[model samples]
Target: MFRNGYKMKPIIATLAGLMLIVALACAGESATPTSKPTNTPAPVATATSAPAATVPAGATATEVPVPAEGPELTSMETYMQSSGYMPEWGEPKTGGIFKWRVSRNNSNFSPNMSGTTHGLFNMPRYGSLIRFDPWVGFTSIIPDLAKSWAWNDDMTTLTFQLYEGVKFQNIPEVPESYNGGKVRGDEFTCEDVGPSAERHVRPPKWETTLKKGQRSLWHLTGVTCPDGPLGYTAEVHFEVPLGKTMSALAQGLMVMLDKDWLEWYNTEHPAGMTKGTNEAYHLGMGTGPYIPGEFKSDIVGEHRRNPDYHRDGLPLADGIDVVILKDFTTAFTALATGQIHVMGRGSWSMTPAQVAQAQRDFPDRITVHPNAHLFGYGVGFNVGRAPYDNPKVRQAVQLAMDRDEWLLLRDAGELPGGMKMLALVSGTPWSYSVEELEQMRGIRDKLTPGGQEDVAEANALLDEVFGEGNRELEISCMAAGVEYVEDCLLFADMMKKNLGIKVVMESVEPAVGTDRSKTGAYEMNSGAVAASTDFGDPDDYLLPKISTRYNANSSAVLRNLEALKVNEPELMLWLEDTIDKQSRELDFVKRHAMVRELENKIYYDLALYIPFGQRMAFPGTGPAVKGYRLFDLSLYSNWSIWERVWLDE
Candidate 1:
């Protein structure tokens, strides 16, 4: 999100001649800081005295009541009437450079090695097997790379036919022995995909593992490349039924790489060679709208439009220039000054005052897009640790603070109702139950009953768990120096006020906080895990929070893991099965019930980490910009689509 602040100042002119010169200099150009007053007008009220003696002179005159005028129509209605869906149209005039400010600089360009943060930019530049069409609510696997595919009834065996006309970006400057010269597009076949999958699945080379002992894992059993009726096809067989397998394949996996390029680079650099890093970072290629042009650590990474891209009409921008500014203030300043066009990755965090100023100043010049992310922000306790190790103590902590109070204090006014607790948002299925949520109120009542912190109840619970007069039980909280930290502090203060248990707050750098959480260094952490968008399976939430094997990085409860494993196979297989709607829904509800039942055992944190409100914002642009929809996913990738954008005269 974009935000700016305005300082209130009184204007006084010392010299009229100098002021006049300043005014003339500013004319016909963008407003400068000293040009105009930023404050708005206040309301004024007028008083009227009643006529006394005048009535005597006009005794026969009668008073008439004037009819009230109805409220005027808003400007939005006027615009809608003036223009249909083709608002101010001709065709969408396209062609201009759209600049964006990214919060971090990414060094990893290799799609195979790029993690989620880097992948956001790379995905659009590099095509995927399947694509998400939000409007259609389904997945599309374009035959640009994969010609076609066949799936078995059991969904265990899947075959993909490869397209002939495809080639990686070619660098003519490089020697022929380097295999940097262009290869015929038709030479690309099914043989390429199998090896890529094999490479991904292979041992210590890549971190992703497919093991048999794990029933719920995303384990691929076999992958084969064979000649087929359509030329050649790659067959992939999974150990278990995965309904999201196709979606995953379309989303991330199956990005085809030139086998020759990979082989040559590997041979030239060998393993662990420093020169290999340069080849991987700079010369690596893909068949996307954009190609990696240059990368410098902690500085800048540039992506240039691909001239040989296979797509019919694509890659709107000439190039994308991404600069990493770890300092948010600098990034925000750059955005306000129009130095950058976009904010890459993560939601924008802004003060309420800054948000108000941006709305007032930019108005139509900026756009704000609010997305529902999967992660939650709340207090998570280590169930194995002291105090929280006891279920009653956990319940007491849940009851101590009203979530509404915390929302008001931390979010300024935003509520958590809009936030998604489980994988799905509030309106969707698998969200929290109304009755169960109301139970929280009852829990609060049990603590204080008077809408205040109940010190007696907290102390009693703590004393019962750790014996009376033992206020020395240590509970460590991990917090960042943000609103989230304030929320944690609020909770901590309430715990002390109501329960007599002293809680310590440990504020750390965001990166350090993440590392600590991953290493299980804190007794309680304030954050959440993000689930996949457009996918609403309960397993996404349940497994990650409770599965010991899957969430080995977390210090989740062991009993929760054991209980989850009881119906693990049933839930896993049922999730992917192509069954009737009724049957599918029933299984989903059953799985949810099992997880909810285990949740009562104090398996996870009492307060499910939910967002108070969306923190990210996109500012609007001027009339010169067109064909851009705020809050909508770019037809291609977030970073790549900027090229297609063009400026209007």
Candidate 2:
């Protein structure tokens, strides 16, 4: 699970010195007014204590006790009992019904959607204000539905508190969906946590989830709570300093909705709600532990549990269906004929040689569960087109192919000459060592085709960047899987047998390769599985693919920094002042030596993307499932953990 040694627990090694409390630097902007209101406590929901208190005037807070039926253990069952993945097949048994599939078809159940296939249909119907310690990494952050929080001092202001019996999710076909007809199961207040964290920083449904230069809630400005319903308390306010306000509220679309059923569905669907065409916001209504039932879209969805599931005894299944196959060899042949008990090894799963031939065709009724794949696999380059913006044609396509033949076409020939990755930190915490990524450079060594699969230095740099045989290009396997058609037919047969080039191939459809890699249409694609910005830091894995505010370089991996802000405006202002000073460095050995000095100048002096291979996550399960355990953290690693699973019989 943690792939060999890499330790750090104490719930995320105490959040890098407990989030360096705050040193302040406008991490990409929005919290203006530096100081005016020193203290304004007039909005109470039950404040008047002192087992240690202090607020907005030098922060303290602390109260927390309430353990009547919750917390006997949970911070994901104490990170599965300190990562030994819990008392194996014991405890956690309530009911069963946990089938699974989903390799596509989820455009709603909005926590402001942004794929993980819409977090397996809205993380079993929403609930957040922190989560992910599901087996530590993603720098931990627990406390969902905020039962305790406080920061102030220099952390702009944080606050939280609420958990007083968290409710919401009664839905009877939206019985006049709140604010008026009120049938969305109330009482989850502090006014629904400051408009659900200001709906991920406002604007007509946040321009459908912050795409244009995504700053993810550009430093959230306001959100104070307290007014009637007697104090659940929220507070919030940020201007971006505490490590980009704790990795922008530890994102998974930063959930927590139901503010009167989202202001009565944005006032009766006023030209909003698109994904899954608003079946009452895709059967949404959270306070999670499951609720939405029988939805359709890519066909078949359901969920039930939540008999007021504010943790007590818990959701040990009794509902969680999901179907939507869309091929991965027909969802690994419906999770190998047991008709699905769990499949999600996401990025549309399967292919570790179909999870090692479904663990040898279900020996002891399967149960793979390998994690460490937020995402990675690369080779992109459309770099403002034409001979891939020539750097000896991206160093003769990384010395004419050979990431161990893309790990033997992703493990089909089974561990063909053992895997090897060039970068995209294997299983992060800045993974290195395969003898330190085979002595770096363009990984496993190669600079301008210096040699690492040299193919005569890649056909003398494709015959001095296209002269003799006019080395062709185009390689767009964007969708359809089987490891993107065996890495586009073995990277077009190793560029026509080591750089006589002429390779073509095109497959399209992951929404047309995310809009033909953002309009610089294809010249070479099949990159970006680079997932994991769900907070774990290495600037959440290299600042959103080399940030320039996420233009993400017109797509097939890294290029446009506004065309180097106009041909090297001092290297685009020192790559935007050192990725905004290493994303506001909250000192983890100085942000790991400023992210290994900007990942060795973006993987060996701006070679601009080519890593290839690493993103595994198996998660199989079926020996009467039991309290299934595989939450290698990012967005609690899929299949919405069927509310802590069940069925030991």
Q: What is the lDDT of residue 258 in candidate 1?
A: 54
Clashing pairs in 2: 45-230, 45-231, 433-436
> How many clashes show up per model?
24, 3
Best by TM-score: 1
- Per-residue lDDT of 27-93 in model 1, one digit per residue for the tens? 2123343324334311111111111111111011121111122224221221223212224434434
* Candidate models: Cα lDDT each: 0.43, 0.55
Predicted structure 1: clash tally: 24
